[model samples]
Target chain A: MLAAAVRLFNERGYDATSMFDIAESLGITKSSVYHHISGKEQLLQMAMDRALDGLFEAADEVRALDVPAPERLERLVRRSVLVLAERFEYVTVLLRVRGNTEAEQHALSRRRDFDTIVTDLVKQAQAEGGVRPDIDPATVARLILGMVNSLTEWYRPRTGGAEAIADALTRIAFEGLRTE
Target chain B: MLAAAVRLFNERGYDATSMFDIAESLGITKSSVYHHISGKEQLLQMAMDRALDGLFEAADEVRALDVPAPERLERLVRRSVLVLAERFEYVTVLLRVRGNTEAEQHALSRRRDFDTIVTDLVKQAQAEGGVRPDIDPATVARLILGMVNSLTEWYRPRTGGAEAIADALTRIAFEGLRTE
Candidate 1:
């Protein structure tokens, strides 16, 4: 039911999508939707939480790893792309949250927390001489995550799958674009 | 006036912002706004076009340069970041267009054209042995542009300025993130 709401919200703008539309797509009455979920806002929150929870869990697992800082960072990026690809609809909606409602505002705040976590990891990686130290860790974090987040916009599972995209992202991000 | 509109639209969102709010913010009458532009939608269109024009012009200038493919690609990325920072609000509004309206749909198509232009440049660079050929050129293009485009979300003119960010982006993008 949440999946149907996400698809409808993604297909039509969240503001444009209605409870009636979600119910219709799910082959249930509006009352059924109300019985199952509090409201459309609740559904949006649930979907965003689903996506954010996956990312936060991945970050935690990577942080718990005994690997070096750079390796941990790499794993986080790889895992993020994989999670995003696997939960494409959820993450897509999560990324597009513009803070119009309380739920979206919560999602935005949590997204920033996730960014700070990545930034701290980047700083650690730089200090350990794994990642480059010249650029500000925050900037590096934003750029790296930006590259990963962009997957939500253009990635299609049919094209190359998550592993292929993840490999390309890790390679391009860690290695320079130059042939040398 | 359009600058003010772009700022307001960026802050309050395009749908929420009204012509009256734009006028009130500008300390002008609503009639004065109508005298200059058709409506709020026109302001959005004008602002987006301003951004797209700058990008297209930069691409054209870079293409005309007699530099190597790698250098050409670098210049395009550098110039794009600079333009994005300089025209921050316009580009911000431009990037957020979701194609709900005719104007937005037009912006989306033109944005795709710009992406194709950059992707072709990456492909040429790869064929010329300038960029690494390991990843597909299209994927490379998307990642690079994604890194650059993320600037709109967090960049502040009072912070590093356009030149500094451009230099950092060029260095990181061309030289990779890992320290040798």
Candidate 2:
């Protein structure tokens, strides 16, 4: 049901999509949607939570390893891209949220928390002389996230698998597009 | 009126923002809006065209220069970012279009033309051994664009000026976020 709601939200903007639309898409009654989920907001919260959970889990797994900060950041970047490709619709909806509702505001806050984790990793890498210290860590984090978040815009599972895309992004983020 | 419409479209989803809302926001009658523009679709096209015009102008300026391909690409990126900051709202609306309407489909096509131009520059840079040849030029173009287009998400003219942000981004794109 959440998946159906996310698809509807992605197809029609979330503000334009309603509980009735979700129910109709699933070939169920409107009340049936309420039976499982209280409302459209609830479904949005659930979908965003699902997307955030995948990202946080990936971050946590990378943090658990005793790897150097650069390697850890690379692993997290690769995993986040893979997670985004895996949960494309949910993440797309999350990224598109404009904080018009409390549910969306919460999602935005959680998204920032995820960003802070990456920013801190960038700082750590910089301190260890693995990353360029001249650039602002926060800026680096945003640009890297921007690159990864862009995958949601054009990625199709059929054309390029998550691993291949992740590998390409990892290479670009660390090694850049220039060969000496 | 188009500026007012772009703001309303960005605040409320484009599908949800009615012509009446735009009229009300601008303190004008709906008839006044119709007198100047055909309808909401016309406003969307105008706003997107404005944004694309800025980017294409920047690209054209760089292409006209006799500089090397890498320098041309860098100048284009910097100028494009400055243009995005200067015209934030129009570009934001341009990026968020979902290709649901004829105007949006046209906007998407123009956007792809812009992307292809940048991709060609990347290919030229690679041919000159200015950029790494291992990654696909299309992928390099997308990632670089992903980094630049991100300015629309969080950039505020009052915060970091366009030049500063552009400098930071150029450094990251060329030298990367790493230190030897």
Candidate 3:
């Protein structure tokens, strides 16, 4: 039922989706949905919470590693792609939120927290004088994530294989866009 | 009125918006809206079309120049950030569309055309031995765009300075995560 709601919300969007529509999608009663969850708000919260858990947990793992920043950041990118692939719909919903609702604002805040962790890693890498010093660490973090996050926007799970996507991202990200 | 619609759609969403609500926001009647455009579909198409025009034209200008590939790419990035800042809401809508409508599919096709143009440039740069040879040009094109496109998700025209944003993006994208 929850998966059905997430799919509908993702497909039709959150506000455009109604409880009745969700009920129809699941072939269950709206009351049955209420029995499973308090309301639509709770459903969004639950789905967002699950998505955040995967993302922030990846951040935590990246932070726990006491390696050089590049290696750590590479792991961050790889782990992120893995997580994005695993929880595709949930993370897609999380990324597509526009912060119009309190639930969305909460999700946005959590996303910012994760962004900050990546920013710190970029900063650490910059401080080591290994990464380019010309760019803002925060912007670099966003740049890395933008590539990874865009995967959700286009990648079909079966097309070109998962490892291929991960490999392409890792190479483009870690290596400078220079012929060497 | 279009501004209000863009603002509202960006704030809420495209599908969630109605002509009634748009009319309400502008203190005008539904008939008054028809005086301007046919309906929501035309409005969305116009807005997105303008945004695409600016982007592809900039890409064309950069391509026509005799500058080095990397420099051309930088100018391309700068121009892109300008469009994102200038056509903020329309581009935001264009980026967020899921291709559920005919107009949306057109927008997506145009977007693909733009990507292909940029990808060809990346291929040229790589072949010239300017960019990394191993990474796919398509992925690199997307990665560069990933930085600029992300600005829509967070950039506020009034709050954020366009030059700084553009410069930061250019620096991050070209120089990369390592401190040189």
- The top-ranked prediction according to lDDT is 1
**Each candidate: chain B TM-score:** 0.97, 0.96, 0.94
Per-model C-alpha lDDT, please?
A: 0.89, 0.88, 0.82
| lDDT, candidate 2, B14-131, per-residue tens | 8789999999998999998899988888988999999999999998899999988988988988888888998899999999988888888998999999999999999999999878
lDDT of 3 at B83: 90
Off by over 4 Å in 1: A158-160
Please give the ranking of all candidate structures by DockQ, highest first, separated by commas.
Answer: 1, 2, 3
| Prediction 1: B-chain TM-score | 0.97
Candidate 1 structure quality by residue, lDDT tens digits, B1-180: 988998899998899899999999999999999999999999999999999999999999999999899889999999999999888889989988889999999999999999999899998998898798888888888888888888877798667578877887887788888876
lDDT of 3 by residue, A1-180 (tens): 778889998888887789999888888888987887888888888889988999889988888888888778778888888888888888888998878799999999999988898889878877776766667777777767887888777766666456667776776666556544
Misplaced by over 4 Å in model 3 are: A19-33, B27-29, B68-70
Model 1 per-residue lDDT tens digits across residues A128-174? 99798988888888888888888866788566578988998888778
Model 2 residue runs over 4 Å out of place are none
Q: Score residue A175 of candidate 1 by CA lDDT.
A: 78
Tell me the lDDT of candidate 2. Answer: 0.88
DockQ of each: 0.68, 0.68, 0.50
**TM agreement with the true structure for every prediction:** 0.95, 0.94, 0.89
